[model samples]
Target: MTHQEPPRGRRIPGIALRHRWISSVMVAVAQLIGTNGAARNQSGRVHLDALAYVLLLAGPALLPLRHRLPVLVAAGTTTVAAVYLALGYPYGPVFLSVIVAFFTAIGAGHRRAVLIIAGTVYTVEQLLVGHWLYRWLPPAGDGPTSWMTTSGIAAWLLAVLAGAELFRSRSERVARERRERAEAESRRAGEERLRIARELHDVLAHSISVINVQAGVALALMDEHPEQARTALTTIKAASKEALGEVRQVLSTLRAPGDAPRSPAPGLDRLPELAEQAAGAGLKVDLSTVGARFPLPPGADLAAFRIIQEALTNIVRHSASRTARVRLGYGPEGVELSVDDDGPSSPRAEPAVSGGNGLVGMRERAAALGGTVEAGPRPDGGFRVLAKLPTGAAGTVAVATEEEGR
Candidate 1:
């Protein structure tokens, strides 16, 4: 059998729920003891009276309402205790209920000024009533005015106030921590969702662009050039298959309860495949490396590859460019990547759709790794994109040597 926790605001069986009954029983016991002693008086036995019994039990009986009406309950209980003491009744644990109510008031978020007022009123009432009671029926010894009695009373009151304040502060701190943790979790979830969206956009956009171009080519040559159309169809099949695999990989990461073997993300090693895809789409891509190559951090590597892919995809879709060049340069500080296309500049040369997110995604990826990207129409003609990424100490000796040479 599974036991589910009750929702918030539902009452649970615990100390708080039983506090009233427990307090009532304690007050009854104290009253019984004090009354028994009063009855043993040799001068005259103090008889039990209905009004005295009612006043003595009033404070304890009201303990259960402390949580709902803390300040009011505290004031009520304190008044009852003061009146009971003033009536020349035997003093006992009547003040226990007041202390509990004070704690409830503090926990309920009563202000410092209100607490001060309550404390002052309660102290003054107790002092006035105790003095009158002492004069009316002097104790057998030093009485409540004795140093020990005064010090003990002061210490008990201070202890109750200090304990209540400490608990209030602690509860507030715990609530603040819980809220902070929830906000942090919310931010992490948002970032994860954005990462997934970026991955899907990159995968789908590039593959679909390639397939779209290949499908167009196949349709254009279906009758006149059957062999080339078949090749175009093959390219479409390959691009779609690759896109499906990448999409599945992204989805698998989100799946719970399964430990599927994870695939390493694409990086610079996939540049040749990207070039081949561009070539199949009728764009000649020439890739070159400079200053040697070094291993990059996983995130940096993926970001670099995606930036290059998005740049090339844009060229295929928007620029009327038939040829493009990709250059990779490594240095101790970071890796630099640039893509230049020899596309014709025309009013219709830009992407079919306005305000595409390709550049935004590229910039976001690079900026996340302390890198930057620049893209604009070339001074002479066509368009160009350049990106610089920071690699830190993880960069290999090739990068260091290249930097030294520079």
Candidate 2:
């Protein structure tokens, strides 16, 4: 069997000592009553006098084990008291031990057993002892109950209440600490995930943007200048290397503690690179605008950058055609980004199907910035992604266009 340690507050040596001292006082009082200021028992039994004192002193030693063995302590006290009574000793200290035992039982969370044992002890003690006192004296005339009787009942009630309060306070403290730890862990996890997402966005946006630009140049030279086409390919290689370096920097930052500052995070300002990279990747990303450019929210720039990055990535991964279009329009209110591809010439072309995390990530990103994203295949044989972020201003004008200026 496994033994669980009690809580720290409950484990203090002082608390056990406190219980022991209280038990010792009770036992001493009982011994004093039994001895009645004399060295011999009522029957002049000197051995009984010595025995009672020894047993009373021993009672305190059992206090340390009160919580661990409440029932046993109660039973032992009852047995010893029975012996003391049979030997014609006074009932004072034995009464106190019984009261203390009742409390120990309650403190141990064995209230049901305490009730049963208390009832049985009260019945046996009263029957064997109470009747004798009653027989010797008629009903009391104007006397507050005996000191032992009144105090024992009051002490038992107070101990049970005190024990319950101690248990409640301990429970609340533990629950509060557990909740704090859980919240701290959750916050840490959220920060780590955000950091990773930012790094991946940076790597992907930089690489794809370079590829789009090179592909555009290559297409421009395809028929008239084969050598120029090769040059554009070389440019693509350089861009890819630069992207790899940036990605490595990001990964390094994630793994190690460093003071090296990172380049500016990707945002709306990097749209040109994104469009150029998509063009290099064989997608003609046409970007145009309407309305005056105004300062966007802190997250707007990054949101714009991500929408375009994912759109271009989708183009590269899904479309078979050599042409795609991208548009970004700044309205009086918010900005809108839309990317569309012409219907693929081959029906066998597979569309990009994110295992779901990508879309969820995108949606989460957009929603966090008070924006929305919609993506689906166009009936006319293409795919489109549109994102709208409300600038929370009235000046924003949204626009949408595709094939036939649709």
Candidate 3:
């Protein structure tokens, strides 16, 4: 029963008033014709009007208030019809206005009130009018019976009531469906926002960590090893540029017009660049692949790349080891990525590897795609991170590896 506000600047009240005016005018014209007694009676004889034309027009004039005061309007129109009939007006259909009022009342959600008011009005008016008609009209053998007239009027009223109720029910159903659709859309929008936030967090955290390490390296070697300091600076430049590109790509996806060209998401294909950047940041990286690589779904591909990137970034930042090995294994069911660093476990590294936002993000990504990720310190050596991701079917496979020579 909640009503929706009409759209702004549309003048809904004026439009409704205009429509009511048009309806009243049509009904008034019909009543005026009936009042003239030009229309024939059921018995083919003209029944001249004894009621004033103004009284006949009054029924339709009351119709404009039906929506606002349903019970009162319906009763008023019915009373006017009865008065016209009692005064011996030609009965060609002065009750048309009464039908409109009854329908309007029911359509405006005043069903019980309209029924009670209409029923009372009909009973009182019918009793008084029937008695008057019985005395004033011709013999029953020559004219229509009072029972037939009353039955016809009852049938018309019932039909109008039923039609209005049906229309109201349908409008309510359509409004309910529209509200449901809006709620569902809002839920989807919220989920998308969370996803975008996670993506931005993962991308920025890893890149910034790399840049921080390289910046430290550049500052440390500035006097002792200027050549190496320049190399660290170069690594910083490349990492920042790549980070900027990835950030732009992520932001472009959120743009409404989508006019900007989008860069492809990084995957296993970018491991060489990733390893080289890590090596420049003071960690030697050896990346290798086993078995044949197959095409992965976009979500699985992005998840795999981010997991690997996060693992490598963690090793470069926390591990004391100078060398790390990354093995990429492709199986019939899925792809496996493992990063093992030859760095001894430190108390600082334990907290980060064991319980950190990086690991949690990796686990979330894997679980979202029905995959799993494992990260812990190796028994005799450094930290190791392993992830397995599913790819539904096998396709054209390729293998590529980059191993740094000692």
Which tens-of-lDDT digit does each residue in 1-406 have in candidate 3?
Answer: 9999887536588888989989899999977875555545344433553445767788889888877887788888888877665555556678788778877777778889778876776665565546454456433323333777777867876787787788778867887888888789898787677667767877887778778888888898999999988988888888888888888877876885346547688887877887887777667778887876667888888888888788878886687787888898887668898999878643444355446678888988898888899988788778899998887654223322211221
Query: lDDT tens digits, residues 26-112, model 2?
Result: 666655665564433333332445776766655555655666788887766655665565454554445556556656666566667
Q: Which candidate tops lDDT?
A: 1
Query: Candidates' lDDT values, in order?
Result: 0.79, 0.65, 0.75
List runs of model 1 lying over 4 Å from the truth: 1-57, 60-64, 84-96, 136-144, 257-261, 345-355, 396-398, 401-406
**To one decimal, what is the Cα RMSD in angstroms of model 3 from the true structure?**
7.3
After superposition, which runs of candidate 3 have C-alpha atoms over 4 Å from their true positions? 1-111, 114-149, 257-261, 283-291, 314-390, 393-406
- In terms of TM-score, the best-performing candidate is 1
Which model is ahead, 2 or 3, in terms of lDDT?
3
RMSD of each: 4.6, 9.4, 7.3
- Residue 242 of model 1: what lDDT? 96
Clashes within 3 Å, all models in order: 0, 17, 0
Candidate 1 matches the true fold with a TM-score of 0.82
